[model samples]
Target: MRSLEVCKCSKTQAWYLFLVLVVITTLSFTGRVVYLSLGEGYGISLDPSCKPRRHVVFLKTHKTASSTILNILYRYGEARNLTFALPFFDHLGYPQLFKARYVKDFERNPSKEYNIICNHMRFNLPEVRKVMPNQSVYFTILRNPDQVAESSFSYYHDVTPAFREAKSLDRFASRPSTYYSPSAADNHYARNLMWFDLGGDHNAQGDPSYVNSTLQALERAFDLVLLAEYFDESLVLLREALCWPIEDMAYFRLNARLRLSVAPLAPAASSKLRQWNSLDWSLYSRFNRSFWERVARYGAVRMERDVSQLREIRRRLGATCLRGDAPAGAAETVPAEIRPPSFGTAKILGYVLRQDLTGPTRELCTRMVLPESRYLSLLQRKQALIKLPHNMENRL
Candidate 1:
């Protein structure tokens, strides 16, 4: 009873339908367009695509897993042959203040815009904006002050005058005010170091009224405030936010000490550290909640899948790039070029590549584990070569 003949579409009709399907598919992926601007400066386009946002200003906060982040940015930029606005004098020192004059040879160079700025500096929005583009996405990481206090005390013990007289960390923790003085030049490092690094008032830690404004200012200034505790998860969100390839974001934790070398924070000490650095604590706690909310927007299941894939990629890269296994705190496994520094009593482990590695693999492995100071030096030399032709570009 049914009709036997099948009706077929003409070539023109089929092609037109095909074209419409193609466009719909493309829009489905690159469809979502969101412009994020908090009532000023520039708006960033948030959408799905293969292309990544190139311009960024990453505030390298003290002992906040910042070294790892710096390496990631440097490696990515170098691959793209991008420029960095590096500071020559351990960051423009106006006794812990940032000014446009801090950018070395500021008056000489023709183009002020840079691709990335991840140097250690006291953040000043007006001054920082002069170096980066209006569309640049700004971000920074904050760690629990409890851990920061320990690391700062250990790393700067030999350098900071506050830690000079104290025989032990417990002593320094027991009576911080005895050693810490806001007026003392390097005393800034011993107290509210994170607050100081972000250009917040070091003295005003507990006063909610004052500290809240600082927190709100950061909320306005930065696109994201990452929590160091959730580093891998944060990286996943960062990769999505920037539309960067997941491969570009693969990382190995650097500048971490041997577990035995790290002093465990006695709960009492942690509480006191929190109270003493109340402003930083306030910032960290609030940002942490916000960090989670941001991740939730990115979808938790997809985030876990990406993180799993990332961990596996790292595992394979480790096998290819490193010796039998990653250093694992064993000194002999590390190479001299990438060896951990003898910073005080901490046994900071490093990595060594395979002897047989060569070509791009070797270079990639070398940079993956390179020390921060050494990498900066290498970048400076390369940048010098880049500048030699222009003559005027030699300012940095």
Candidate 2:
């Protein structure tokens, strides 16, 4: 039997080996590197002895880089053959308070313990608790309210009543009162959308006591809250929390809008946007501070090093998995199978895998950039097969 072992190597040797790995991955070579336990010198593993956390609940927020994080969860869970608590359709009865029944398997098997829950939903803690294990770690992501509003307006221009009435993000921000009404249909997307997604009242006044209490409640609900602007740092902290290897967290950005589609908010408009979404603004501001504090506790130098290592791995993966060998490979002509589901006017981008990729390489690369809708469908089918009757399976 052939045996391979890891040994300490110089920086130059490590870099050369990394290049070789990238080439092998790109060519879809079957030759495997049995093991390489690179310590701090090569910047790979944080704690090899620690078991990777399996049970997790990721609250999928909208327009805050949440899709990218969701892709990470998808790859991680699927690779391990772990069960996901998926919704009946795309989301868990989103826009309504989530219940245990919103999960596909819950009605069929209430006692089933899901290894993951990362679907979009209006979070309801009690209902979530019914599906996920007691030890499941819960986390979510947040973005600046200004950015969220701009992205939402562009993405939901036709679907959202306020966005359609205002016609432009700036116009909506300038005199939101004219376009926005609490009674308007789908108005949650117009203001404090992040807050609303977290099961908070989008139309609530930002009274000091109320906002403080809401923040306090959130503090208890989630194990970690990631900020979109500081996504890399967030991942570093996440890796630590879950005791996961760095490569497990690598991802390709999904559901990203084309540059031209993004409508930039003027400084004054940005301020007005924040004001219009005061509840979300308050939520973001409070957590943004705590995120930094958490990083400080993790050590600034160590955090920076891990983040850099993660970026390098991401770059290498992009070269191997995506077309054009760019860090973010844009699909030349978006394929129908993988094309992102269109929402109003925003044209979300997808990716193309290199033609030569085969076997496991192709599978890994494909999942890395698969559109969320397609991935969800694939998972649904996979879970259904798992639950299928054994005699019925033989017929198929």
Clashes in predicted model 1: 0
Candidate 1 lDDT, 1-396, residue by residue in tens: 112211244455445446655644432211011101111122123365446889999988988999999998888887766787877755555346777666765666636668888888898898888878998989999998888888877777887777887756677777777887777777777888888888988897477788888889999999988888888888888877667766666677788877777787787767777777888778888898999999889788977877776676677667767876756563764566787566766678677678997756666777888888888877776665444334222221
Q: Which ten residues in a row have the lowest lDDT in candidate 2?
A: 29-38
What are the Cα lDDT values of the candidates?
0.73, 0.80
lDDT of 2 by residue, 136-237 (tens): 999999998888888999888998888889888888889998988888778888889999999988888888998999899999999999999998999989
lDDT of 2: 0.80
Q: Which stretches in model 2 have alpha-carbon errors above 4 Å? A: 1-43, 325-331, 390-396
**lDDT at position 37, candidate 2:** 23
Candidate 1 residue runs with Cα over 4 Å from true position: 1-50, 89-95, 328-334, 388-396
Q: State which candidate has the highest TM-score.
A: 2
Alpha-carbon deviation at 127 in model 1, angstroms: 0.4
Per-candidate TM-score against the hidden true structure: 0.83, 0.86
